[model samples]
Target chain A: MTAKPKLAVWKFSSCDGCQLSLLDCEDELLAVAGAVEIAYFLEASRAVTSGPYDLSLVEGSITTPHDAERIRKVRRQSRTLITIGACATAGGIQALKNFANVQSFIRSVYPHPEFIDTLATSTAIKDHVPVDFELRGCPISKHQLLELVSAVLNLRKPVIPTASQCLECKRAGTVCVMVASGTPCLGPVTQAGCGNLCPAHDRGCYGCFGPAEAPNTASLAQHLAVLGQSRRDIELAFRSFNANAEAFRREGNAHERE
Target chain B: MASKTPAPADRAGVIARAALDELVALLAGRGYRVIGPQLRDGAIVYDDLARADQLPAGWIDQQEGGSYRLVRGPDAALFGHVVGPHSWKRFLYPPAQKLWQAERSAGGFTVTTAAEPEPPLAFLGVRACELHAIAIQDRVFGVESGDFTDSGYAARRQAALLVAVNCGRAAGTCFCVSMQTGPKVTEDLAYDLVLTELLDDRRHDFLVTAGTARGAELLAGLPQRPASAADLVEAEAASARAAVQSRAMVPGVADLLRQNLEHRHWDAVAERCLGCANCTMVCPTCFCSTVEDVTDLSGDHAERWRKWDSCYTLEFSYIHGGGVRRETAARYRQWITHKLSSWHDQFGSSGCTGCGRCITWCPVGIDITAEARAIRDAEGS
Candidate 1:
């Protein structure tokens, strides 16, 4: 038998929910453990293993100067680097800081502002280093995370859906919250996954999975305005978990000025 | 089967609206899994029903482009509302289904084909336009077509029973009148039974007509009253009033779309189009699907599954190096052209049933009818 692939899980800055998703794959986690050598995953193990890792599952954004530099070294050492979840792929909720003054925020939130070292903007892994693939969500889904791992190990393209969330909602038989009861939903612009949860519960999607393939955020913003959403409401909606994603950032910026 | 001259026009009778429960019981007893419309997730959606009371009895939907609202209806009419987003196609060709499962067996592998068997279905409250959509799908999925057919779809569609409900009032988005498909379930369409709900201050009843011999047999077993000439007149008036369609499809759309293949209006539509697959997912007639093959982590088991796919997605058109239609403009053009123009070349009939679902369910409220007209008007200009 060939050598088991070396897998590494890296974190820069995040709540670590995305890393938890891999651990959440209870049955699949055991199988994954047997299939590959988990060289590094501080979330599950602390015994440090040095890279070059065969596959690096990166979580979180480049929030600090150190992290921006650290990602470059990680990328150089790994054969295939996949950024998982919105934080690593689209800058996560921490990227809300991208819009405002980071120094002022530090002064307000911390007692010793000088000790808090951070960058002016919370940015994605791709902003610093080239990403081979991005598996998106606020905290990435367990199934998608597994598919990404399996596909990467086997040298195949992951079967992750890049279509808008509306496809899954319709397939799950959830009525359109936007059309059905005039709810302002981001499902039209958001990527599929997250189990199509929001609309199933009668609430609008908060766009945790970020922009889907060829998302026309401008068109959706206009539709949201027609649905009676305020420009600020529209801005905030797009500036959620996946705020710093390219398509969503541009849309939120478009609304913010107005 | 369509050649068996149209159904008897005047062969109808009246049954109290509450008698639908008895009919449900009868169908359920006959090993058919009965399904009907119910108020679910703020809209009327097709779901499993054991009793007719599960129907959206006193609710009506006010639907328009990108909007739908379920309001308390004026009266106690079961089939008061027109078709909602959920259509009969979901049951016939489900969104996702396992095609085959393979398991490791002694040095080789053994494969089990087809998903688990489902009982025959009985769909209640099927609108006339919906019936037309089903007939269109039959040509694509059933043995009725001379060429390729899905064996599973053919089997499920053949065994399913349709109990259609004629429209008494049209929704603002309805254009079935222009499509020449609805306001009434005309003969030549396959349905076990057809009903036109009649509501008044004095009584609430349905004028039921049997389209097939099975429908006649079921009607014979049910409690019903021979229709009075007045009842017949009222039923005719009800369907006639439903012909008041607020939207209409332009005639010769197949030719017009073909002529305007490079029309600039498509660019205007792409500007508003989200490229979301909502319209195709809601459309009863859109039948494109893609397959996926997966293996367990142990590599002991593998399976193939088919899921509904739409042309709006770049992946749907992707081949080899990259996606064929890279721009949103091209994808939108491809969808409309296939649905309107090339569909005729393929299917010998229009693919659209004028259900107006695509219009109402679009995120940006892009009207297909209005788009077609814009292109048609641009021709003269």
Candidate 2:
């Protein structure tokens, strides 16, 4: 019998919610362990195995110079590197720093700004090194994480969708909160994955999954303007979890203090 | 299958507003799970209905671009206003469905296909445009029309019994007349029973007409009176008024959209488009899906699930390296063109049923008819 595949989980600058999603897969954790060697997951296991790992699931954004160097090493050691969550794929909510002065932000947030070793911008793993796949979400969906892992282990392409959240709302038969209640929903331009959460709760989407395949953010922004959303509101909407993402970044820049 | 043919007007009758409850009972008495529109969460949504009291009684919806509200109607009429955001596609297509499951055993992985028996559904208060949407979906998923038919959708659709409601009033967003799909339920549309709610100061009744033999049988069970000439005239007038009120139109939209792929208006519209895909979600005919294989952490058990997907997302057209429609403009153009132009080539009809849910539901109030007209005007100029 062949040896099991070695799996490694890595983190950078994030809330650790994406990695926590893996641990939160309480029912699947044991079975996943049985299938692969949990070589290096500091969050889940104390047991650390040196890499040249079969598969590395990288989470979080590269926010510091050390993280930038560490990711390169991780990429070198891993046969297949998959980025998990918005942080790894498109820079997480911390990417809001991309718009502002990092030095000022550090000084504002921490007492000892000089001690902080950091990069100017929080960026995705793909920004520094190549990624085999990028699973998009704020706190990535546990089901999608499972699917990505299963696909890698089975030697198949993961069938994660690149569609908008609007489809999810429709499929779930949730009434259009935007249309029916005049609520400003971002589902039309946001990617599908969070299972239409905000809309089901009678609120607009916060765009946790980032920009969909071909988001018409400009049209949506204009529509938002018509809906009595201020320019600041539109800018803020585009500057959420996936703010550093190209589409959202461009849209946000368009709405900037020009 | 013999019941597929149109029944004569002899099957048509009138039912008092009070006796409408009996119709709900008769459908429930059968194995069918009756579904109807009910006021919930500040909007009218389709839900399980065992009694007539659950219907959107004395309620009418005011719908426009970026606006919707539940308002009081003239009387306690059950089916008031036009279509809501909820459509029949939800029940037929479903949000998420299991395709198959696999479990590791001593021999190997054992695969079991999903075979959960779905209860027969009786869809009450279905609109004419909604019926057209269902028919469009039928063609898309039916074995004869498409290369591959979705067994789940096909099964659900086959077991569905449609109870259509003829539109008496058109919402500001509705343009079903332009699409020739609504404001009136024609006999050829395949609705089992069609009800035209006739409400005046003096009377509140339904002019019920059976379109098929099964409908005729159901009508026979309910207490009814022969439809008078006045009732027929009143029913005709209601649909005519709805048609007149719906001023929004996109005449020759298919040809216009097909010819103007490079129009600058696409860029203008793209600027405003958030690409959130609200229009596609609210749209009844937009039937795209994606599948995922989920396993237990133990890795012994796995299930393949399919969920609704939209074209608006960046990854929908992702190839080996990157997505084809990378620009928001390209994506927006793709959606509208596919809905209006390409749909005729693929499905032999426009994808849009002129049910302005996309307009009203859009957070930014982007009207498709207006876009089509703009494209046409640009091309002409």
Candidate 3:
């Protein structure tokens, strides 16, 4: 009597981390299958169910002309579109390629540059098509993924946290690695969901959860400088996986180049 | 379900040793496993408790900023140490958890969720601060927005029997009193039973109170004496002493940090920070992480996993073509503000617990308390 909800998983240019998160739900994988119909997921299954899907999870950045055109098709096929991970929500690590010349990159990587079919810049899913919900994380947290699925099934807004990672650290009773060890951490400004993993292993945060609501990144950067990190060091830190993100890129560019 | 509080007088002057044996038997009888601190690998760590003899007695530990050492106590007393590096988190979150598994099948492909194990447990000697930490986690993983959702965690939490122990001696890194969470268990309803250790020159007894029917049942099976008014006075005095001895100070800190969100102090601290994610690792509450996938040698099957990640990592903040907090300065600024100021707005509480672990464990020794103090002084100028 009840129709099974149709689900689709889409990918662009990425490391496949976010889509992998869905499959990573090893314990809940079968339950998820029973809850919904898998309309499309190139990574998980060979069978493809044509859309007007109930739910669509989009991953990776739009890095080529074909990718830009493909996202529009994905947008048309899905009723509710959710972008997963840094590549889909933001442009992702590959967005760092946007800083340099794409033509040169293609030429260097490939002997024949003319064979390359790529765009000038790497961009997020929102840059190409409308996104209903944007889940923040390099590889989105599986717990959050489960919540999104549940919220979607219930037809309610997901109650994902908008606060910073610092709250999570405090809740976990971890000593501030930054304050205690002068190990520069990004938890104060980064969003929560990673389950305080880095701090648990006696390491500082590296901003994998992206920016929290209304982050004060400028102030934290100044504090790190006072603790004795160099400007080049600071710049390098920000320019890592998320270097292509607008906020981090802007700040990193302002720093003195070593 | 919460339990009813039993009469305090009915559960007084109970020797701690006898109570331990009784608790172990009660847990074993109830079809629950018991785990507590034990001496292993030259350190006190969490392990299974087979009987009362497995407990660490007459062993006290000396702890200071950035250091911990086990030392012999004047008397052979179990449960003398404040806490170890490992908490209850290891059992719940686990260092590694397989999210799902994928196998190539005749019908194209199949993905299966990992089998979940619901293990019932009884934690012995849970301190007030640790209890607070668990409560905080309850708010996180128990909700829809939280990064982790484990029915197993919920089931274990629901079935576990909490026996809260009030801290009588302060570890050098402890500042729970400053955080206003310990020395005396204010949220007595959170636990099924509470024990206030009564130590005098001639006697060592614990004042026990049953919080639920389960606690009452456990108490009825034990031998106890009526608590005197003097015993209550002594307990209050012990708590007061801890509050005074607290070393952390961040007066009006959350509000102050919120008011000066654009201050230049954070930039200074950024220079020394490595963004290595050590702080988040050591922090009891930092929960940000990443997901990973690995394939079998034949490449026919693949499995996915969630690994811990940090905001300090450059790729974590990427958006569009770049990161929002580009400099370590901005990254550090974002981190401190969220902890001391923004966290209050979101969680209705300051993120920092005044635990000096961050200061002591930091490889470079960046003090959070001092950071707030500097901010306060800067605002004044």
What's the TM-score of every candidate structure? 0.97, 0.89, 0.57
Candidate 2 wrong stretches, greater than 4 Å: A102-114, B1-11, B95-112, B143-155, B258-262, B274-276, B288-350
Which residue pairs collide, candidate 1? none
TM-score of chain B of 2: 0.96
For each candidate in the order shown, give its overall lDDT on alpha carbons. 0.88, 0.85, 0.71
* Tens-digit lDDT track of model 1 for B108-163: 99999966778999999999999999988988775586568888888888888889
Task: Give the candidates in order of DockQ, highest first.
Answer: 1, 2, 3
What's candidate 3's DockQ score?
0.03
Fold similarity of candidate 2's chain A to the true chain A, as a TM-score: 0.97
lDDT of 2 by residue, B1-381 (tens): 114767566667999887779999999989889999988888888899989888888898887777888899878878876888777888988868899999999989999998988788999999999989998988888734456887778778877888899988888889999888878999888788999999989888999998777888888888889998888999999899889644465688888888888888988887777776778877899988777766654567788887676687676787899888888789889999999889999988889888998888776778898888888777955
**Model 1, docking class:** medium
Docking class of 3: incorrect
Rank by lDDT, descending? 1, 2, 3
Q: A47-118, model 3: which lDDT tens digit per residue?
A: 988889989999899998889999999899889999998888778888777777888888789988888888
Give one digit per residue, the lDDT tens place, for model 3 in B1-381. Answer: 354565555455454557668778878888777878877533466667878678777676555543456678666556666676556655555545678999988867789988676557777777777777766665556632446566655666777777777766776777777676675666444776777767666777777776677777777777776667887777777666556554665777778888877778876666556454545555555556565565532334667776555576565686798777777777777777887778778667666665455555544456677777888889844
Candidate 2 vs candidate 3, DockQ winner = 2
Q: What is the lDDT of residue A15 in candidate 1?
A: 95
Interface RMSD of 3: 11.4
lDDT (Cα, tens digit) per residue for candidate 1, span A122-198: 89999999999999998889988887777776566678889999999998888998998889999988899889988
